[model samples]
Target chain A: MTREHLRILLPVLSLAVLLAAVFYLQPRAMSYFGLNLLFNLAIPVALATIAQMMIIMVNDIDLSIGTFVSFCACVTATLVQDAPLLGYAVLLAAVLVYAGIGAVIHLRGLPAIVVTLGTSFVWGGLAILVLPSPGGASPDWLQSLMKSKPPLVPMAIIAATLIGVLTHLLIKRSSIGVVLQGVGGNERALERAGWSIVRLKALAYGLAGLFGVLAGMALVGLTTSADANIALRYTLLSIAGVILGGGEFTGGRVSPIGAVLGALTLTLAASFLSFLRLSPDWQIGAQGAILILVLAIRLLVTRREAN
Target chain B: MSHITTTTPNRAAGLRDLVQKPWIWAYLAAAAAFGATMVISGGQGAGSLFYAALTFAAFSAIVGVGQMFVITLGPGNVDLSIPASMTLAATLALKFMDSNPSLILPGLMVAIGVGMGCGLFNFALILLLRIPPIIATLSSSFLFQSLAIWSNRGIRVKPPEPLAEFTTGGAVFLPNVALVAILIALAAWVVLERAIVGRWILSIGQNLRAAQLSGVPVNLVRFGVYVASAVLAGVTGFLLASFSGGANLNMGTEYMLMSIAVVVIGGSSIAGGNSNVPGIWGAALFMFLIVSMLNSYGLGAGVRLILTGLIIVTVVAFASKKGYAA
Candidate 1:
């Protein structure tokens, strides 16, 4: 296969192998309900992966995403149900803050990682203030919407497909996406071409923030409650997902469909581990191991392609 | 312009130069935090507050020094595994010691050994797997943390009695832990300012390709730095566990951010190449003091966190603006 085709096919193949392994390990997981049980938790993770992909598209990373999502969920559970306008207003302000952060990082040449690291604390703090003890309930509509069953496939799979297709169109096929990717690919070239680098960065961050909000809401929809540190692990999970999906750290290269698939693969890997009766303590370590294995495979592939 | 006025101008210039130093901001912030906390408490507990800040800041300063070196290797080169390394080292060492006083030395060795192993693993992943340091360290930390949890099963193993006393006790009016940290800082300063290895790190951070072409042992230097960072983290974990009377699974959780924050707030360039050892101490103290100030003012965790974030952002902005001007 051509390198281009291989590049696209690798993530798909990995997902297929992982899913097959999971099903093989637990024959019952082949059914619709079983598949839903396995993949349902991946929805928020996929959303988070897409969100991280947006930031990476601009050659930046968002360490605050996990906490930001938790904040959004907290707002959704508490204010969205009680004070709808305030809830949305707070989330909007948070996104604008993200945009402002992008603008500042671009203008000042500050490191996005450190700035986001600092903001993680802010988001965590805000989340706690919003819902101190995690008692807020998801709106009935959201819970029902998340629980709704589809005809053939599970809601999780449908949502994953929808996210992949929509983001592919928005980021891969749109003009704005071109500009955004340009900012990461060759920032100076984009600037020379009369594009405002700062504006492009802000737009990317804003969009990522929007996705983060979606991820949070989706998470709360599934869990039906929220806590300050609920989705804190999503930060690393999203980064790992993005990488597993064939995304590079510095380059503008990203794959929406691949990232979603990557998220699903990770979810399946967890289920696969459980099916193997692996100890819960090692589950996290297995995640790290999987990430290492996938990256190692990519390295070998790149070397082969070079030959 | 007159000859008699030259002395005054020289003095003014000296003050200006000192003010221009990036590390000075951290000290100023530290002092401000101290003063605010003092004011809030009606000038009470000044000595105790300073001592407390010193005690807590020591751990952050130690980890910050290690992180500073890694970050100095340049962009996307942070060691996110510090917390995990600390937890693992502490857990294993404490378990090995089993609270026996004679085993303290052996336990320290075990902690250092664990640190070296973690560092080696991190470096191997980065080199062999071609994984970025941030991602590599992050993933490896999960493994380390898992090891920690698996071995201890959430048990909090107590330190040997004498070891705990040594960690928590004061010597010559200074906390022993603070003294140990100061010694480490001094050693680190000597390395960064006087050693060839430090130069290699700085040059590499400035420009990797250029540094490589200059025949710098880039990989070796990177190997040493990563190992050093893990070793320092391991030592900090050991000390912290002893000082706190035991090791807990989540004991290292706060240090991950604490290390990075101290590095940045200490006025070290986040972009790498440039760094400050004195500033780490100042930033570490300021971090602790600021928390104390916020708590004394009856602010909730949310407000304290928000203020801390805003303060870090503002400091970084000002620091960067100065960097640009210089």
Candidate 2:
């Protein structure tokens, strides 16, 4: 295969290998019910990964994505369930805050990592103040929406595919997508070309916030409840997914489809380890090992191509 | 003729410049907070509270020093493994020296050794595999956390007596831990401000390609800083576990952000090429005092976190602007 083909095939190939391994280890996982069980938790993670990918596409990172998602979950579970208007208002405000963060980082020439890191605490604090604890029911509409299963395939798989396609087209096929990538690739050049870098970056962060809210809502829908700290681990998980999907830190290169696949692969890996009855501690270590191994393989492949 | 200047004007400008140093703000803020704390407490039991805050601040300062080292390397360089490594150190120290008090010294050595190993691993991942520092360290942190879990087996162990005594025993005016922290800060000041290696590190941070062309051993200096950071983090973990008399799984989670906050609030540039040893200590103390004062006022954890986050963002934003203006 040519380099371009290999670049596209790498994530797909990894996903296939992971699926094959899981199925071989436990044939039951290949069944419809088992597949549902595995992919059920992946939807939220995929959404979160996509959110992270948006920020990274602009050459920025959002350490607050996880906490922001948790805050959104709190809103969905409590305010949205009780007072729909207030909940929607707060959610909209949160997205605006994300845009403000992007604007501040760009206008002040601040590092995105630190800004997001600082905001993570603020979001977590707000979530805690809102919920105080972890006992809030998701809205009936959301619960029912998440529970709907089609005849042939699971709802989660369908949702993931839809999201993947939509984001891929928005980011890779559209003209605006080229501008966004251009901002990351060469900010000075883009500015000279008369594009507003600040506006583009803020738009990127706004999209991240939108996806973060969707991820939180999806999580609440599946779990039927929300907690201030429910999605705390998603920060690292989302970043890892983006990287595993062939995303670069300083480049605007990213694959929405690959990111979703990466998220699914990670979720499957976690479930697969649990199925084997490995201790949670050991499973965590094993997952890190697996991530390292896959990245190492990709590195070698890239190195060979360079040679 | 253009070089002529008035003597009084020059002196006033000099004074202004001195006052304008970013690190000085941390001291001013810390003093203001402490004064506020004292006034609110009505001077009753303020002494002990002050001492307690200092003792805790010492731990944070030590970790902040390590973080400062990494941040000084360059932009996009960070070590996220510190918390996990510290937890692993505490777990290992407790397990190794549980029954025998005399084993405390050896346990400390072992913890430091683990830190060294972690540092080496991080170096390899960044230099050899070309992984970004944040991701590399974060991945290793997960691995270390898992190891910590496996080692402790869901049990908390009390620190050995000797180690405990070292941390807990001290005069009312100055605790042993506080003293040790000051000494470490002094040592760091000497190395970073007065040593040739410090110059090399700074040069690299300022401009990597320029420093490389100028015959700087970029890799060696970078490696040294990472190792130094890990060692300092390990020492902090050992001290913290001993002071608390026990170790838990989540004991080190807060340290990660807190360390970064200390470094930032101390006026160290997050982008690179600048550091403030005394300022880091002052910032750590300031943060600890704020938390304690909030606790005394019965404020909730949510409020405290929000305040801290706001402080970090505002300080970094303001300080960076001043740096650029200067």
Candidate 3:
């Protein structure tokens, strides 16, 4: 197989193996309810991973996405419940701010990681200011929408499939998608071709912000509440998921379906560990181990390709 | 040509060059923060405040120097595992020492060993697995943090009495921790300015492909830098645990950001290749004083965090612009 095909296939194959392992360990997990329990939280993770993918598409990374999602959750739980229009306006402004940050980063040639690192603090601070102790209630409609069960496949699977297809169409098939990825692949070539790098980067960050906001809302919908530090671990998790889905940190390589599957794999991995009675402390270590193992496999595959 | 002039003119040019240097901003900011704190307190407790700033800033400076070395290696090179390594080293060392005064030396050794292990693992992942340094360090940090939590379950362990006293005590009106950090900074300065290894680092950062072809021993230098960073973090964690009376699971959390902040604010190139030891100290002191000043003004944590983030962005923006101009 070509490298691209392998990249897409690896996540699917691993996810299948992981699913089989989970089913073997707990035969009950084969049921729709068990699947829901396994994959319900995976939606927000997938959303966040897709959001990070957008930033990576522009050869940048958003370290602030976790905190930004937390901030959005705070907005959703409190403001959206009490004042719908004002809350939405605030979220809209946040996406614009993200776009502006992208522009500033490009204009000044500042490191994206450093700049986003700074913004993480800003977002975390804002989240705290919005909801100091995490007691705000999610919107009723959101809660209902998230809790509703569909026929046969469960709501989680339906949502995942919808997200996978929509994002694939938007990011992989669209003309603008090609141009955006081109900016990451070869900035000089695109600039020489009269495409504006600044605009593309801004668009990429804005889309990331939009997805991050959606992820936060979905999380609050599931949990029915929000906290400042709720999604802090999502930053690392999203990056890992993207990589597991065959997304490179540079060169604009990404697969939306693979990313969604990657998120599901991670969620299932956590469930599998819990079923094995692993300590909570070791769960994080297992995450690191999984990342290493996947990367090692990729290394082996690449070496064989080279030979 | 300027050096060939008369000594007086040469000295004047030297002073002028120092003024124009980007590192000057950090010192000026530190001074301004100190001045602001003094004003806020109406001149009361000046010595105590200054001493506290120095003591706290020392930990940041210690870790900041190590981060400086890694960052100086090049873009996309950073040790995100510093905080985790610090926690793990301190936890393991304190557990091994078991608060026994006689085992203090052995405790220090354990901390350093843990640091070296973390660094070696980080490097192995980067080299053997071909993972990017950013992701490698980040993932490794999870393992370190988990090890720390698993080992002690977040229990706070006390240090030996003598060690604690030494860490917290001062000699000649200067904090003992500050003294150690200053000594480390001086050694780092010597290495970066006078050693061939430092030159290799700079050359590699400037252009990796060219440096590799020109025989820079890039991998060895990288190995040394990563190890040095982790070792420093280890030592800092040891002293920090002693000074604070115990080691806690969350003790190293803030330093992750603090280390990087001081490096950038201290006038080091965030893009790598250029750094200065003096800037690290100034920036460290500035960071502590800035927080203290904001606290004295009765600002909430939310406000303080927002302002801190904004100030960091502003400083980085200005530093990058200065880099372009120079």
| Candidate 3, CAPRI quality class derived from DockQ | medium
Per-residue lDDT of model 2, residues B1-326, tens digit only = 00112335658787576568678777677777777777778877878877887799999999999999899888888888889889988888888888478898899898899889888988888888788888788777878889999898978788877778889988868889999998999888888899999898888888999999999999999999888888888888888988897877888888888888888788888878887788898889888887777676777988877876787787778777876675
RMSD of 3: 2.9
Compose the digit string of candidate 2's lDDT tens values, residues A1-307. Answer: 3764666577788878888888888898887787788899999999999999999999888888889999999999999999999999999999888888998899999878888888998999899988998889989989988888788898888999998999989998899987888877899999999999999999999899999999999999999999999998899889988887778788788888888987887777776667677777766666566667667878899999889
Candidate lDDT scores, in order, read 0.89, 0.85, 0.88
Tell me how each candidate scores on DockQ against the true complex.
Answer: 0.80, 0.69, 0.69
lDDT (0-100) at residue A44 of candidate 3?
93
Which sections of candidate 1 miss by over 4 Å?
A1-4, B1-10
All candidates: CA RMSD in angstroms? 3.3, 3.9, 2.9
lDDT of 3 by residue, A129-150 (tens): 9998968999999999999988
What are the candidates' interface root-mean-square deviations? 1.1, 1.3, 1.1
Question: Residue-pair clashes per candidate, as listed?
Answer: 0, 0, 0
Off by over 4 Å in 3: B1-12
Q: How would you encode candidate 3's per-residue C-alpha lDDT over B176-219 as one tens digit per residue?
A: 99999999999998899899998998888889999999999999
Highest TM-score model number: 1
All candidates' TM-scores?
A: 0.97, 0.95, 0.96
Model 1, A48-167: lDDT tens per residue? Answer: 899999999888888889999999999989998788888889889888988888998999888788789888988999999999997798988888888889989999989999999999
List clashing residue pairs in candidate 2: none
